[model samples]
Target: MVRTQDLTYSYDARHILQFPDMHCAAGEHWLLLGQSGSGKTTLLHLLGGLLSPHGGFVEVASTRLNNLSASELDHFRGQHIGIIFQQPHFVQSLTVEENLLLAHQLAGFRPERRRAHELLAHLHIGHKSNVRPNRLSQGEQQRLAIARAIINRPKLVLADEPTSALDDHNCEEVLALLEREAGQVGATLLIVTHDGRLKDRFHHRIFLQSTQA
Candidate 1:
């Protein structure tokens, strides 16, 4: 579901980052391991179509991201890619359920109220459906973020530093939830993290070296 070749990105002429080729099949769960400056998150962004690569190409679910126009990329990402950032960002004014409903709408699908509730319930936050996001605890908020990302049943799921801030128990819980939910939707799961706690959890792994040249 995800592939990249000779992918490169640069913030300036002095700092160029090059990534190794990668391939992760549909429904597979993989871990992207790297140190702080290894460009793991950058590669994830390129794959998700949030950033255009300086060289080479990113393909997800058979679509070559480099060939898409900005609007087309946005639409494609909304419909096929789901991302969970290190920090969750939400529409603070909107209720939890509304935030998820908006995800479906943005993906060009009718908002399915039942699905939203079901997802929230699975995440153990169904009671917060009518509450504003800002009112939830950090753990609850993260669960909500997970629900929002998969609400559209994306073909690929990208998570960046998802367990860095959690305790051991919570870390395990979050990882299990991620794997379970992604499997339920048959989505390829790629987690970009520097956390050592995850090294043994995934059978498929990609290790990146720092390329800050």
Candidate 2:
């Protein structure tokens, strides 16, 4: 679950972004629609505890992010928030499976090799378990990113412009995977995107106006 109130962020004295209030229930899916410079990504980072807000607060699963120390926020985010960045990033040296295991380790949870394998299989990439990430195709890499994000069974899943680069078929495929996987984990899914292709897919949405002032 997520709740935000009077959220405001500033890059400097001259530019400040104000975000609308949001209340999303657990296990629900919502879309955050906004144009470029509207602060969609900035809001996502605040919600994920990746960026500290200059004003107001972000609460996720009942924990207020503004109250957490840096280390605490990092640990909390690792355990509770799963973020799928627009671009998938991986440790090129690690195999697909190893990358997943590393997520568990970083979260302070014991590595679950079986869970990792099962998740990859569920994502239809079990065969690539031992393969390095760079060798995978774009679609495969995307699936790997999805797999990595939810492997910890996080309570909240935040995706940024997930379908921006995909063709229609691939875009739908990726969205389906994100929804199904997040559903399986009982996570509240919030996707931040400017893509019109996604508008009709989600009934619950938050539209942000450009806060350029």
Candidate 3:
């Protein structure tokens, strides 16, 4: 469901980071491991079409991301890619359910309250569905982030530093939840992290070296 070839990017033309070719079949899980400045996040953004690559190509679900217009890319990403950032971001003015509904609407799909509620219930945050995101606890917020990311049943799920802030137990729980949820939807999952604990959990792993070095 995801593939990249000769992907390269740079900020100011001094250091161009080139990534190794990658291919992940549908529903497969992967670990993208790299140290700081290794371009792990850059590759994730390129795959999601958040940043245009300087060279090569990113294909997600068979679509060439580099060829899409900004608007088209936004639509395609919203519909096909679900991203879990290191920090949870949400619409402060909207309730948890509303925020998820917004995700549907933004993706050009009709808002489905039933789907939002179902996801919240599945994540054990159904009670907080009407509450503002800021009112939730840290763990609840993390679960909510997972819910939002998979709310659309996206084809690809990319998580960035998802376990960075958690204790070992919470980290395990989070990873389990992420995998289970993505698997439930048959979505391919890729997690980008520096954490070594995950190295043993996933069978398919890619370790990236800093191109600058």
Candidate 4:
């Protein structure tokens, strides 16, 4: 569902990252391991269409990101790629449910209350649906980010440092939640993290260092 070809990214003419080639099949779950400044997050942004490549092609679900206009790319991103950013970014003014609902509403998809409730319930936070994100615990908010990421039922789920802040139990919780969400919708799960321990949990490992140009 996600692939890149000879991707080279840079900032201020300094090459920050490069991918000779990469690919992941639909429903594949991959753990991306790299050191700090190893381009893990940059690669995730490229996969999720948040960053345009300075070179080579990137395709998500057969749609070439380089070919799309800004508006079209935004629409494509919303409709197909779900991203779990390193931080849990939520609008403080909106309730937890509202924050998630807004994500779907932006994509021209009516929020499926049943699915949202189910997701929240599965994550053990259904009762807090009406509360603002700030009122929730750190764990609750992290789970909420997972909820929001999968709310649109995207074809590809890109996670960045998802397990960084979690305990052993919460790490398992988050990973399982992502597994279930990706499995339920047949989306590919591509997680980017510096930790090597994640390799044990996932069957497929994409060690980014190996793909460096």
Question: Which candidate has the highest lDDT of all?
Answer: 2
Candidate 4 per-residue lDDT over residues 109-162, each given as its tens digit? 987878888888988999999999999987888899988888888999999999
Query: lDDT per model, in order?
Result: 0.93, 0.94, 0.92, 0.85
With a 3 Å backbone cut-off (N, CA, C), the pairs that clash in candidate 2 are none
Total clashing pairs for each candidate: 0, 0, 0, 0
lDDT of 1: 0.93
| Candidate 2 per-residue C-alpha lDDT over 44-148 given as tens digits, one digit per residue, 9 for 90 to 100 | 999999999998999999999999999999999999999999988899889999999999999999999999999999989999999999988888889999998
Better of 2 and 4 by lDDT: 2
TM-score of structure candidate 3: 0.97
lDDT of 1 by residue, 1-213 (tens): 899998999988989999999999999999999999788889889989999999999999999999999999999999999999988889988999999999999999999999999999999999999999999887888788888889999999999998897889888989999999999999999999999999999999999999666
lDDT of 3: 0.92
Show pairs that collide, candidate 1.
none
